[model samples]
Target: MCRWLAYTGTPVLLDTVLYKPVHSLIDQSLHSRMGVETTNGDGFGVGWYAPDNGTPAIVREIGPAWSNRNLREIADHVRSPLFFAHIRATTGTPVQQTNCHPFRHGRWMWMHNGGITDFHRIRRELALAVDPELFLDIEGSTDSEMMFYLALTFGLEQDPPGAVARMVGMVERTGHEHGVEFPLQMTVAVTNGQQTWAFRYSSEGASRSLYYSTEVEALRALHPDMAFLREVSDETRLIVSEPLGDLPGAWNEVPESSYGVVGRKGEDDLLPFTPQPV
Candidate 1:
């Protein structure tokens, strides 16, 4: 399990979200209150798209984010309208930069906060399912990375939700075939530079915790004296594994088995998500 945050709105320095929050992702790396583990210090990553750049810039490391000077330096300097940050706590996978979250390919970036139940039993079948053309790009040995590639093989670029449904369906089917009772668990985030999609689901009824910010204008009215609210755009939004701080009415839980989209024009939409067989 892990902790992650995705920001989309007006361009803001990365530190605005990564470091300034009272319970920031960096702080969560050492003291996560809701994660399965209290600490997620195995490794970490951040991905962001620069203005006019279709591809994202990714910075990852194989050490604790709390003590990573490089992460702090970059966060203080880089500004982006859309970005992703994750801190990891290994679930059997080795701790390595290549195994970090916010995996990227071309203009797309993906991060996950759950595991493929009994992944080792179904690994070969799932690995074989990835498009051979994309197989060569697999750089890490984590179920989360494989899940991203599986979605890609199922046409993620054109249909993110549909692709993920098919991906989950395959994982569940493979798990059942191997005698696993519940096969999938995930709270995932993906983006293609323009629109961002965040999903919460599991084979079991309950999934991990995921929340998104309430509308900025509403928060402004609730806390008129907060200077930070005035600086960001009305459309400013954040989707996270957990709330960054304790601001009342500032965050809303993403519905179970549903997905949300933050579009290029700053439109927000929530839709039901269900796994479908490929």
Candidate 2:
């Protein structure tokens, strides 16, 4: 239902990925070959952490990423060690800035690229499940924002995987009660300025496309003449909804129903993910 990309590693100008890639996020916004829709012109948002310990800065707009001068300007000038960019195609939610992806809460930033099956039917139940304190933070009508708050309510800051699993499980249970099967579908990314966690899961076996960048050294060896490969550190990694380019070995598909972590110390780990009841 949308397209998104996350970068964490050596700091680089946002334009290096958002605009300069062979098939960049901006290109994906206009002619996405792998997304459910070809055009994600509904809206877009970008969130980035500063070089130090601080909350992330977010810029969202209610228009196409391909044509947004503000996005282009920010992409051209903003340099960050980590950032998230998303182009949205609404899945029944209104096309407003508040409903955009990459929803933020203090130090955390989240974005998703799928829908909660029969979300309208279970919206009230899910919303009521959020901690009343976090409920006030709900500013949009999208299921994605609701999912983020739900995760936080379940302890995202302390245990991301567990919290997310509980949130998903709660969603599935709610859907089942409403007579809907396969109640969840999502490719999600969340970060707290130091580490990033990305998940690929759905109640059904099939899910939206999600990929993570291969190590920079591996790409350098695979494409010896590529200059950009030399510019980034070996720890530099990216998680994306689709491959940024056609280069082989540049990206790897995240396994079905699994999650990957990009740690602050530059380590990467992958593990199986299963939802647990709260």
Candidate 3:
């Protein structure tokens, strides 16, 4: 289990989201209210896309985020329109830097807050299913990273939602073959420097908590005096494992078994998500 957030909007210092909220990601690393664990201190990572770079910059460390001086400094210095921050609580993998969240490919970034049940039992099978070329790029042993590569193999670069659904379908099919009744759980986020997509789903129908920020225009109407809301663009939004603060009408729970897209053209969407057989 972990706590993560994705931001796509006007460029702002990472500190505005990671450490400024009442229940910020850094705060969640020690006092999370809605995660499986109260403290997610196994490791931490942040990835941000600069205005000119197609590939995002990621900083990961195998240590508690709450005490990480480097993360604090980076958060204060970096500004980007799109970014992802995650605090990890290991399920079964080693607490190593490579195993941290916000895993990267060529120009895409991904992070997950759930696990594939009995992953050790089906690891070899799933590994064998990945495209050989993409398989060579896997840098971590965690199921989260494996899912990223699987999605890439299944065509993430061409179709994000479809690729993820196919990835889930493959995991579910393989898990069933191995006798694991409920094999998947995830609250995932993916971005390629422009738009961002978030999904909440589980094989058992009870997914983990996930939320997206209310529309900036709507929030402005509700909290007229909030200076921060006044500063960001109407297209700005945040998708998170949990709400960042207690601001009334500021967060909306993502529907169960559904996915939302915060698009670059401001054509945001929330749609039903069903795992498709690969």
Tell me the tens digit of each residue's lDDT in model 1 across 24-119. Answer: 999999999889999999999999999889999999999999999999999999999999999999999899989998999889999999999889
lDDT of 3 at 94: 96
Clashing pairs in 1: none
Off by over 4 Å in 3: none
Q: Residue 244 in model 1: shift from native, Å?
A: 0.6
Name the 10 consecutive residues with the lowest summed lDDT in model 1.
261-270
lDDT of 2 at 246: 92
**Cα lDDT for residue 159, candidate 1:** 95
Worst 10 residues of 3 by lDDT: 260-269
TM-scores for the candidates? 0.99, 0.99, 0.99
Q: Taking the tens digit of each residue's C-alpha lDDT, what string does model 2 give over 1-278?
A: 99999999989999999999999999999999999999999999999998875699999999999989999899889999999999999999999999997999999999999999989999999999999999998999999999999999999999999999999999999999999989999999999998999999999979899999988888898999999888888889999999999998888999999999997568989999999986
Candidate 3, 1-278: lDDT as tens digits: 99999998889999999999999999999999999999999999999998898999999999999999999999999999999999999999999999999999999999999999999999999999999999999988999999999999999999999999999999999999999999999999999888898999999999999999999999999999999988988889899898989999999999999999997656699999999997
Question: What is the RMSD, in Å, between candidate 1 and the native fold over all Cα?
Answer: 0.6
